[model samples]
Target: MRSYLTRLLIVIQFVIIIFGLLQNENRAFLKQLFLRSDAVLFNGSLYRLYLHQQKPRDSMLVASHAVDDYSWLGAEPFLVIAHGLGPKLYGGDNTIKTLVKGRERGFRVYEVDISLTADNVLVCYHGGDETEINAMRYADYLAVCRSKGQDPCRFDDIVSYARKNPAVSFVLDVKNRFYDAYGMIRNAVGDQNLGKSFIPQVYDFEQLPFIRKDGLFAGEIFTSYRSALTNRQIFDYSKKYDVKVITLTLQRFVEQKGDFPRDLVILTHPVNDPFIAADVKKLGARGIYTSYITHRSIPELFTSALFFTPLKQV
Candidate 1:
């Protein structure tokens, strides 16, 4: 691994020099570049590993088998997040228009953040760092989003649309720890007969025990991985519960890891760069979880499963 470290450092140094030369004024662009640099560094090192593969086709990223593709069902493609109408970073946050755009892009599964207003209403809103959305009720929350021109809507607002489009699915990333919040969301989804259409993306592993008590199936819901769990523990949890799990992994864990289970999907926040998608695959993940919508997220899978070709591939 000594040579690997050397190569990584060299790539990082090269990236810094290139950034200095560009001298762009946009802070968002610069921030995105810096975030993507890790993937570039990791992918650069991966080329070396590929040069010395131990088996025939061991280096190829293209997975022919459905199970190896990070999909529980073989028939559908697993690349899920497409925020807003377009894949551009400077787009609206989870708008109805964006959901329509994701469908236009051939994505069946769309991830949306759900925050509970203090009055127990679930709304589609992005949870800001350190911001507790549940502290406010529907009126305050709606005003806040409207003030920012975010075009936010209630969870039921989106689910009603899902009910209309039978093929579409929504993965709800709940932002509230309130018991009533869960109950309200469950009621809204069930009342619309869209329970199967919506999937809960829960954060706390400690809440797993309460999942069933709260009316949920382990295999149906996904866990948003935290630093509290190691890669091995994450793998074990998914295996035991038969649930899909999402892990936040930077380059530090990518190249060094030797194996990964098929259900463990690796997620990177605001993944503007597409190379990170390829690198995630290199880490043996099922797919990637990203907020920014882009077909280039995983060009290989994007092209292979274009239009989610078959309804049931398994």
Candidate 2:
């Protein structure tokens, strides 16, 4: 472990020096880099470095079986969630255009934020000041988005799209309002559709009781981004509730120590850096929630952890 840490630190320092030198050489280039997404500015570039330094196998895997429409692996070539629709142009805006762009990139699972409007309607949003968001009706919010040319979408809009495309799935991040937002989604999409298309993320272990009682969603993901629980406690609660997936921030996972059962799926968030992604995989994380990483960027990194097997193994 000591030697591993030494090597890791060396690699990180090398990356920083390389980027710093490049930035110093061309200030205009740095400004252009600023225009890219958060993942692109650092993580994506780091991933390019990883590809060069560590020559992972360069091959594509063919699907072994037909897509399971009810499962999360309908079109998932990689075990990644497209954070905020995955489009750099309007990333985290949660609009129809963003979803389209993410789909174009072959992303089958998307993580989107949803909040309630003034009239108790659920809309895809990541707004601060919930009181202010709660003061605007659905129509008022739509008008505001149009005035800003954001092309916003509601929770229902996403559900409608999902019904049309059964291959796609959504991971809902309702922030702090887990129960209220989930109730609204259940009503809008119905329990059957909710089971088929949506995976609700629970923030706190306290929400597990409600999850157990409701039993509407087919699966649930416990995201420890805001939760105060330790990794072991979270893993226990997840196992108790049959929540198969657990997501933690990269820093959080690195800090925590414990063994997660092999059957449980572990994922880390906002991992666009292939070096960090590989490190987390060594630590037992099976997947990631990424803003910019895609199968096209590095297919080799995803070959091992995919949900489906390739028909013809090389």
Candidate 3:
């Protein structure tokens, strides 16, 4: 009787496992697991069935090394923008030290948060209350940075740095009062380099017309994290404004992957994991805004097999 009961329990557990495997909530976990290039004993009919369910007639997934794994990313080369000057190496985000470190590591593009002071000075800062920071005078802001042992960077300093490194580009994250920030930058860098070097990130479609009317900016990237527009509206406005790249949160990307136009370059933010980055890239992300990943680390990231070779259906 004991032996019979044990066998029945084993059968029940097997059934439960099988049932869990087929559930929708578990599909994502299973997808990540089976897609791993290093997954052992995962090459049988079960793998084939999962692939078939995800897409009816896609190519068979082949396991390959990191070098070949990202080959699908295309010849354009994946661009990485240093988030807040690439992760507080010298101090916190938007500091001159971090910016210099990012540039040394071969990052030509950087995202800097620009806050306008009460004295109407443009500075690289993102902290505390936006209104309170905006209300403080430039001198007072500098004093505050000194008190906190943080290095403060002004727009003038950024312009000077850009003048020295002409190839560098800045993606301005001006939370509110974008027009004021734009005019200040234009005044500093001149109208010629306003759009070329200092790219303004518009929060919504309404802000586009104001920036677009003057033709002051050469390019504009739609940062959709804060946007309320539907995917269709986002795509439509992108075309109308000639926006070449659109940025959204990773969660947003996962939810609206099918709605986004594949032809456009879609960028996602704050991806630190090489595995997650690989996953998103395979899903059609062209670039990422990261704090840890850089041009210098790509080869090392691959050699270590952090980006595992999945059972890819070609």
Cα lDDT over the full model 3: 0.67
Better of 1 and 2 by TM-score: 2
Name model 1 segments beyond 4 Å from true: 1-78, 83-91, 129-131, 191-193, 213-218, 221-227, 250-258, 262-270, 291-314
Candidate 3 wrongly placed segments (more than 4 Å): 1-75, 191-195, 300-314
What pairs collide in candidate 2? none
Task: Summarize candidate 1's per-residue lDDT along 171-202 as a digit string, tens digits.
Answer: 66666654566677767767433555665565
TM-score of each: 0.62, 0.67, 0.69
Question: Where is the poorest 10-residue window by lDDT in model 3?
Answer: 62-71
* Candidate 2: segments with Cα more than 4 A from true spot: 1-70, 73-78, 90-92, 129-132, 135-140, 143-148, 191-194, 212-214, 257-259, 304-314
Q: What TM-score should be assigned to candidate 1?
A: 0.62
How would you encode candidate 2's per-residue C-alpha lDDT over 1-314 as one tens digit per residue?
99999778756755555576576675454432332222333433443354342211224221221233226733343487888877747633788888888888867889898988878778888777657766778898788787777877888899888888877888888853567877778778775645557777877555655654544554667897665444665677666655677887765566553366777788888887776666566667777888767777767676765342211110
- Candidate no. 2 TM-score: 0.67
lDDT comparison, 1 vs 2, better candidate? 2
Tens-digit lDDT track of model 3 for 91-138? 778888888888777777888888888879898887667677767788
Alpha carbon lDDT at 69, candidate 3: 18
Candidate 2 minimal-lDDT segment of 10 residues: 60-69
